[model samples]
Target: MLKFIALRLLQGMLVLLGIYAVTFVLVAATPGSPFSSERAIAPEILAQIEAFYGYDKPLGERFITSLGNVLQGEFGPSAVYANRTVTQIIAESFPVSIKLGSISLLLALVLGVPAGILAAVKRNTWLDYLPMSVSMAGICLPTFVMGPLLALVFGLILKMLPVAGWYGPEYVVLPATTLGLYYAAYFARLTRGGMLEMLNQDWVRTARAKGVPEHTIIWKHCLKGGLIPAITFLGPALAGIISGSFVVETIFQIPGLGQWFVRAALNRDDFLVLGLTVLFAAMIVIMNLLVDIVQVALNPRLKYD
Candidate 1:
């Protein structure tokens, strides 16, 4: 098990390194810098800007310097953010993103699990229809579209929730729902499938024959078996949310990591972009690794080591 975990960890590291390389290359290939979008500058001012950012250096040299900086936990500063370092940008933005993602994850689990269980238990009835229909609707609506629609209905028409701004729990409701519903659909589908399969297994049949209570058989035996695959999906799902809800946060103007991430990528803020990219990629990779370990531990009969 340790060997398996070690191997997976190495693989995860390599994958994140590749993701970092791709993002860096794309950022380097962009036509202009964030400074290019600014007003015309005198030669001395240009020199100052270039020198401050090491933009005047050769590309190879800059890349090497940037790599060294990354090793030292220096993500560099944002030219657009008035001398704020990428680390500082993330420091402020991460909390909001984390809060949003955590809320969304809770919502996804709360909605998805019960819906999926009911859908499976009452397979031929309206309960099944309801969850499937909801899942379809959720998958059909991207967060970009859903975020605004929610704002319109819940915020504008009803005026129950705030239309914009990240104030507190109420402020989180729409964005969390908008981000979570799609993932809920995904989890629901996965859970339904896993449950259907587990329900048919020989062990489940034996449990029923031995007069085990239906609830115990379903909850204790079937649920754990059903959860293994869902657990895998849940890990990455969580990582994605943790990185930030770009559309939901943006639509609501939450001023989270997603806001800076989008702006940095669009504005060609190299250091900021690279930093955010690496942060996101690293999170995803780490989550996946944790999923692998958990999957192995839960199914002890399976042997990878």
Candidate 2:
């Protein structure tokens, strides 16, 4: 297990390096300087400012310097934000993103797991069909569309929940639902498939033959094996939720890392972009590693390797 973890960490480091290299290359290749704005500066002044930020260096030199800084956990100054470093911005905003993402993840699990179990148990019945149909619709609708549609109904028409801002729990409902529903659809499908497979196994038949209660058979005998697919999907689903929050954040006016991320991309704030990318990629790698470890632990048949 230690060897497996060490190997995975090494691979994760390599992935982070590759991501940094690719993002740096793309940022360098983009046409505009981060300093470009509606207001023009004198050429000499611009040159001095560029030199101050080491932007005057060759692309290769800048990349090397940036990578070295990143290795030391220094993300450098933000080009667009004037007085802030990338690290400062992330520290301030990431909690908001995490809060939103965690709630969305929890909501997805709550809505999806029971529905999936029911669908699997009640196959060919309305109890199966209704939830599955709704989940299918959820899958079809992307967050960008879903966010506003939800806002329109719950916020505008019904006038129950607040449409925008990140002030309180009331503000959380729309965005979290919009982000969660998509992943819930996937979870529901995965859970149903896995449960169906488990229900058809020989042990399940044997349990039924032994006069075990249906609920007991499902909740105890089948649940662990049945949830394997959903567990496997959890890591990627979480990563997707974080990335997808960028759009949802915009639609809902949330003051989160997603807001900074989107602005960094649009403004070509090189340091900010690279920092956020590294942060996101690291999160994904760690989540996947944890998921793999959990999956192996849960199933005795699965070796760590």
TM-score per candidate, in order?
Answer: 0.92, 0.96
Report, for every candidate in turn, its global Cα lDDT versus the true structure.
Answer: 0.84, 0.92
Report the lDDT tens digits of candidate 2 across residue range 1-305.
Answer: 99999999999999999999999999889998998788999999999989988999998999999899999999999988889999999998888899899999999999998889999999989989999999999999888999999999999999999999999999999999998888888889889999999898999989999999999999998889889899898998888788669999999999888889889999989899999999999999999999999888878899987
Give candidate 2 misplaced runs (Cα > 4 Å): none
Q: Give the TM-score of candidate 2.
A: 0.96
Off by over 4 Å in 1: 1-7
lDDT for 304 (candidate 1): 79
| Predicted candidate 1 versus true structure: per-residue lDDT over 78-108, tens digit per residue | 8677668999999999988988998899889
